[model samples]
Target: MPYKPQSEPGKTAYQPDVQITRLGEKIGDPVVPADFPHHILRFRNDRWDQSIGLHSLNDEEWLSHFGKFEPLADNLYPPLALRYHGHQFRQYNPEIGDGRGFLFAQMRDHEKRLMDLGTKGSGTTPWSRTGDGRLTLKGAVREILATEMLEALGVNTSKTFSVVETGEELSRGDEPSPTRSAVMTRLNHGHIRIGTFQRIAYEKNEALMLQLVEYCLEQYYGGVQTDDPAAELFAKVAQEVAKLAGAYMTAGFVHGVLNTDNINITGESFDYGPWRFTPYWEPGFTAAYFDHEGLYCFARQPEALHWNLAQLASALRLIADSEPLVAALEGFPKAYGTAFTQHFCWRLGVESRGFDEDRDLVVAAEKGLAEKTIQIDRFFFDWGRAENLAGLDENYAAFSEFSTLIADRERSRQPVSSYWQQSGPCSMHIEEVESIWDAIADDDNWKILSKKINDIRAMGIALRIG
Candidate 1:
């Protein structure tokens, strides 16, 4: 079926829910939104709104709900600040929670799966220690670019649903003297982080731990029929997290922060802080400037996420036996290997022959990338057209296996669209991101950003990925 943009969106089909509050005060705290002097709507994602049935909202209603923090119909009134503890940089930190954000609403997507609408830069809550609970406009812009590019690359990431500029000057030492402020709404699967489980276990609340596990099984992992729901849920989360790490690797994304709190149970990547796309297949690429030791570097992402999953296993032991959780942990490397092959094959627009051949294809592509240092996106784009392949020659045997493996497979999508026929692929390098922000900051020009998004969406459509 051909994909069609909705001529009319945001209909009354919105199916809202408030299941997060069912965990009661044990999971979160009710909090008020920050009052800002002004509210200027920056961006609203109409494509995603159609999924949640909020596409028809005019600018005023959009601002009223997202900017002013007005509650959605049948949604949480005073939004709840979720509580959790995380391992930051391999060290336990009980002080972390939803310090600057809170769950604003819940609804079902077009697939009828439960989804969360959360906020960033909302206001300070009990968890906001010392620092001001605010997000800079540049930060929001960076997130927009990151999520857009990641989504186009077939990564399971959060959508920056709405961004509204709030009139305020926030002081920060990182960027400039006083940066502009904004509030952003993130739409994703759920906010149940591995840290959520860790907090329950840290408190030695066995009943709450059981409750959390049961809720996860019922809502997130409903297909698991095992008697040991906790164990099965841990295994399912492990699989999903492995797939997420695989996506990051294939997308050449460095999350920069993969703490336990940042690893959601659904494996949906969110909270884009200091993220970077590798300029090429630079294995040691680090996104965050503060990562002195490169703790969460590009190649070490799987390790970082595995460590986080271990923390979740440590927490799940309150209800599940240690053996099953350990077994699940032991399977991370295998699961990651399978997912990386599948994702790599998909991105290359090639049909998979099997696990062995797919893995071989991936190894060949990596060798090809390493030998010539071909930029990741350009390699993918050039692969679609044999005429544009600059480095894949029989004279160089490093990419010969790659050429042979690719020759046996056929294109995944027939009659490939012209998006791949362009002179270049849509990419989100740090320089391009900074240039987009510079446009907005210098001339208040949003046209360049808008065009980039259109180009990315066109590429995504051409890629024909879910």
Candidate 2:
């Protein structure tokens, strides 16, 4: 069934009486601003969707609904049309920008937090070239699910604001034949990317490149005060990207594609293309169909990010020496390690140590992967259950009984040993694992297990049995 978007009940009504900016006009003639194409568009209004009803308010309606001429205060954030270059498939393509998107406006949240409200699939611009500049409906659906799930898992990410179906049919080679399109409104710190730096660098636009460095520092890294802005810029960018690398690894997420174009200058996860949570720990498992070499595989994401950040640093050579950039790059491993540790600690419901236990956890997980062939989602989902404890008896009495469920149900015929053997050694480090047998020694275990279940449920994860 086709999905519907809904508005929230109590959201402050927003009416978008957008003011066209001169900086934005030069690169993309204004559908609302300059440099924007004539065919550019805003989403159509609809009311049936329960999910994004309030947020999905049309641009004009948003202005009227909020009873404000501008949802974002003027002169606060100059909406400039960004120009950038990128490498596509290892080949440098020096032309790209928000060809189908743009920075509409920026605003301060209730907490004085600054954020940009940007649109995707808003339509063509000078950078759109001959492309239709339309986004498939599937893309919008994917973004919503991706952002929601990532948030639940406690990852820092851009929030989805609204998705408006354009009522336009478009054909793209990559999408299902006869695809429908939509425009997405999303919130983020800034729409800048590493490709933004690459573009100006390739053009030898030294002035603009310096302007971008200053802009990024002021907009995203307001804390770092350095005499050399260029050096500070690359230094800050490198650290943020590395931190994001650690966060991605901890969540077992594969961004699938980490091209320079996808590396946001704000270090917020954006451009959700071919992303997936790991179903299992296969190093080569990939989410993007076009990633034939697995360059951005589950295991390769961190290194790929380092490489991308290096490219960004290389471009800074025009303004800053390479040595300082290299020095900043050296800090990546420690930063990434620390972030991943914190995230992993949260997921495991434990206090974090200062470094990664990722490799050890991966090794331990693989034992079960090889032995039980348990589905990744299901294994984590069911491991906390009472039935799982019943399978812990050393004599294999309860374990044998539990096997009937798997054996008779047709999920597996292999004994629990297949998986247990591989993970047994690692289990020694986990406290209370051996107690599973004793816990299940009588009915007392059920009461204890019930309390544990409720605790995890309160953590917003429902570990349902398969």
Q: Largest lDDT belongs to which candidate?
A: 1
lDDT of 1 by residue, 1-466 (tens): 1111112123347889878877778899999999878999998997788889888789999999999889998878789999999999888999989989999999887777788999999989999998788999999988988888888777888899999999899998878868889999999889999999999999999988887887887777765587898898999999989989999998999999988999989998999999999978888999999999999999999999999999999999888899999999999999998888888877777776767878888998898878655788877777755532355544345666687778768777653588866878888898998999999989999999999999988877776632
lDDT by residue (tens digit), candidate 2, 46-110: 22111222445556666332222133534324434456777665667876777776676654433
Worst 10 residues of 2 by lDDT: 1-10
Q: Please, what is the TM-score per model? A: 0.95, 0.69
lDDT at residue 291 of model 1 (Cα atoms): 91
Candidate 1 local lDDT, residue 430: 88
Model 1 TM-score on a 0 to 1 scale: 0.95
Cα lDDT for residue 228, candidate 1: 90
Off by over 4 Å in 2: 1-60, 63-81, 356-466
Q: Please, what is the whole-model Cα lDDT of each candidate in the order they appear? A: 0.85, 0.56
